[model samples]
Target chain A: MEGRLARIGLRIWVGGVLLFLFVPIAIICFYAFNSSNIQSWPIQGLSVKWFSVAWHDPQVRAAFVLSLKAGVFATAIALLLGSAAAFGVHRFRFFGREAVSLLLVLPLALPGIITGIALNSAFSFAGIGLSLLTIVIGHATFCIVVVYNNVIARLRRVSGSVYEASADLGAHGFFTFRTVTLPMLSTALISGALLAFALSFDEVIVTTFTAGAQNTLPLWIFGAIRLGQQLPEVNVVVVAVLLLTVIPVIIAVRLTGGGGITRGSAAARSAMDSGSPGA
Target chain B: MTSTVAQGGRPGGEPASSRHAGGVPGGGSARLAAALWRRAWLRATLTLTPPLAWFLVIYLASLVVMLVTAFWSVNPFTNTLVHTWTLSNFRQLFTSTYLIIIGRTVGMAALVTVTDAVLAFPFAYYMARLASNRGRQLLFTAVLLPLWASYIARVYAWIVILQKGGTLSWSFQKLGLGAVNIGYTNTAMWLVFSYIWLPFMIVPVYAALERIPDSLLEASGDLGAHNWRTLRSVLLPLALPGVVAGSIFTFSLTLGDFITPLLVGGANSNFIGNVIYSNLGTAGNLPFAAALAVVPIVIMVFYLLGARLLGAFESL
Candidate 1:
């Protein structure tokens, strides 16, 4: 009887927490159809007018395109560099291997604002203009760790003997890698790239510093929210961005076999363990 | 078998023989592949150099440059960075106004961490232990879904809910509880920060709780401990590391966030991030911004070290 009562309490608490999490999201979705320009109590009325407004806004289109382009370029660069780093760290023991792993994790483990300011200062000092290219570079720096973590975690789970066996069977390194290793790593890479893209897509802080005059979708959203005149239109765009970001995340989770989004923290733990003496 | 033995005899033989056996045309590329296969160090170099060089040149070099910039001064009249070394930037950071901003930021970060932890523990406990497997998956997805949702939009949801005559006020009025507006206040910032970072706390705590063996919980019960005792003694201690791990995210995210304060906060709310942002963008004081940025870095380094000692990294 006591256990049953406790269980009831827990279920209620969990439900409440879930409501807290989702109510805001549902509100965002509902308000996308809100007709009024000003956000007031009870959302004056409902219509689809804001959707057309957001669609026709050229600045919104430009920002959306810029975000997509940056996410793709950043994710691509991250895949190449992250997988290579993972393979290197996994296959070989070397001097400063710990340092390398630490360096990769720092971009993520530290605050984004620090990463923003650091990159911003560096670009100015080096006379590199802040543009889409700089934004991609800034993003790729952090995105590499996401891919690195995913690939490295997958690498650890996969046995090295497969590669040795392939080599032993008269397969060259390239052939072995293509035939065996690539198949093993495909899901991890795909999920990693997706997550990286999701991250880069919605990133505002680092993009703020590296973008200079350019506006990514989130930066544009920030401006619109601040301006307050475009509340209804911002809601439409927010819902659209919500779809864009959440789809990739859900797909990535499914691709990773729905273990919950623990890869980021797990990779951080593994990286830390690899650096420690007894771990 | 002979090929295997010969390949064992010469490390490079496998690639050469494989090329020949496959009847593929040999070229300089094949020879280079053979050479790379023969030398582990060479392969390592080939794989490691690009990523490592990128980190060093772009990421680490920038951090070092930012650190150096923090030591320099900016000319107020011209709004240009004077390259000459000075300690004024750091010295100015010690003043009371800046100190209060730092304090407010740290205080909010701590408050948010605690709020999320308290809210997350019960939800996570239920998901980890009480829920059916199917229910657990659904709940897990629910927790994760918000994390990927646009953070700005989620925060904006609060503005609609908390602003004057917003949802909360409407609900209150319907209930005859009188009108209330907490919008654009620190209270609103607190609520939003707690709401925004809750999933980050949930994921790790759930991972930690799910990892605890059912046998251990059973053992506690078998040993004559009641449910509350088992939870207090066995569960909470094991879940501490996960709590600590989650706190790292909640803490650092709030510490460095200027957007929440900018969007949700009223006039009095100035976080360290806001100060750094204003100095960099509005004042054009890059050196001062870099100096201010160092505060979070130093605080986090210490916090991370403490968390490491507490085994939070393992939980992460």
Candidate 2:
């Protein structure tokens, strides 16, 4: 009886913690449809006016499209770079392989503020016009590291001899890759692509530096807040952005979740044993 | 190797081992040997160029440039940078106001790191050791799932909680207590930072706790050593790396994040990131801002190296 009571107490504590984590999100979702123009409580009449306003806003739409464009291009570029790097790292015994790997992953560790300032300074010094091109290029840099890690880890799982065997059977590089490598890596590739897309899409800190003059979705929101132009519309757009970012995020994470646990975890262990999990 | 393979191959492609017996030959070789080495190198370059260029130009070179500009002088009146190298940009960085902001940022990061670490340990432990397999997976996913959510949306979500009519106060009022005015407070900043960066803490701790072999815990119990001692002596040491990783994520992120403070930190609660943003944006002092930004990176380079050294020691 005492043990049962103790278990209930622990469970209650768990519930309270989860509630703390989730309640704010739930509140934001609730307030998006809020009839009141201001973000206030005590139930103003329910209206979807803000949502409509958000939907019709041209600036919001443009920012949305720009973010989408940025996300797609960034992910594609990162994938191309990351995939090749992964292949190179997996196969070649280069002298500075570990150094290269660290350099690739270092951006993730360096504060986004640092990356932003660096890119900002670099762009200005070079007199390069900051546009969607600069934004896409900026996003693709660190985003590459994430995709590279995912793909390389997955590649490690696929036997090296498998690729060798295909070559031995007189198969050309492209054909062998299409048949043998692509099939096994397809899942990982999809997950990595989705992850890259999400990272670029929701990214704010680095984007602020790279995005000069033009605003992506996140920057647009920040601008809206700074300008204090439209409150309810801002709330509605935030809700929309939430949905946009969350859906892909959930999908990417869930898809990779199982893989991260079983085969992925065992690899982490063995890598730890070797004292280098590539950080 | 290519010549050996070609010389070793038979017409029928049978007994491929014969390719090993074939030695390197002159330029005259089989039909399929169409400049393999050259092609491989070309393919490598072509495949590798885009990412390499992007990294070099955007990420790596940009940092080098920022470092250079941090030491340069800029004329605010003309909006032009002076060619003269100077330390005034850096000298002005340690002013009383900026130092307070830096201190606040580090203090908030520490608070968030500590709170999140404590909260994550039990949850991760239960999931790793106590929960059923499916249950554990679900909890772990729930933990990592937040990292995917929109950053702005997440920030806005917290405004609802910390604002005047937020649930914390509403509940307090419900319980016949006075409402808590958390808005624009440091508490609000810490709470939001902890929520946003909680996944960073969870993922690593979960990974480390999961790595704690089940048998080890059982073996401790078998020896009649209580759970506390076992956890202290075994689990803590083993999981320290993940804890360090989590700390880095929370600390570095909190220190660099102007976003959280902008959304919730109010006017009085400006951090170093916010200071840098202001100096660059509204203040229009790029050189001073660049100097402020460089400070954190210099701090982190040392911090990351220290973490690695400590990680090396912990592993040993």
Top-scoring candidate (DockQ) = 1
Q: Write the per-residue lDDT of candidate 2 for residues B112-204, one digit (tens) a residue.
A: 989888877767666665667676656655654566678777887777667777666777888898868887778889988998887777666
TM-score of each: 0.91, 0.87
**Deviation (Å) of B71 in candidate 1:** 1.1
Q: Which runs of model 1 end up more than 4 angstroms from their true locations? A: A95-98, A259-263, A267-279, B1-25
DockQ of each: 0.47, 0.41
lDDT of 1 by residue, A41-149 (tens): 6778999998998999999999999999999999999999999999999999988887787788777667788999999999989988888999999999989988887
Error of 2 at B244 (Å): 0.4
Provide a comma-separated list of chain B TM-scores, one per candidate.
Answer: 0.90, 0.84
The whole-model lDDT of each prediction reads 0.83, 0.71
Q: What stretches of model 2 exceed 4 Å from their correct place?
A: A1-10, A257-279, B1-50, B312-316
DockQ for model 1 equals: 0.47
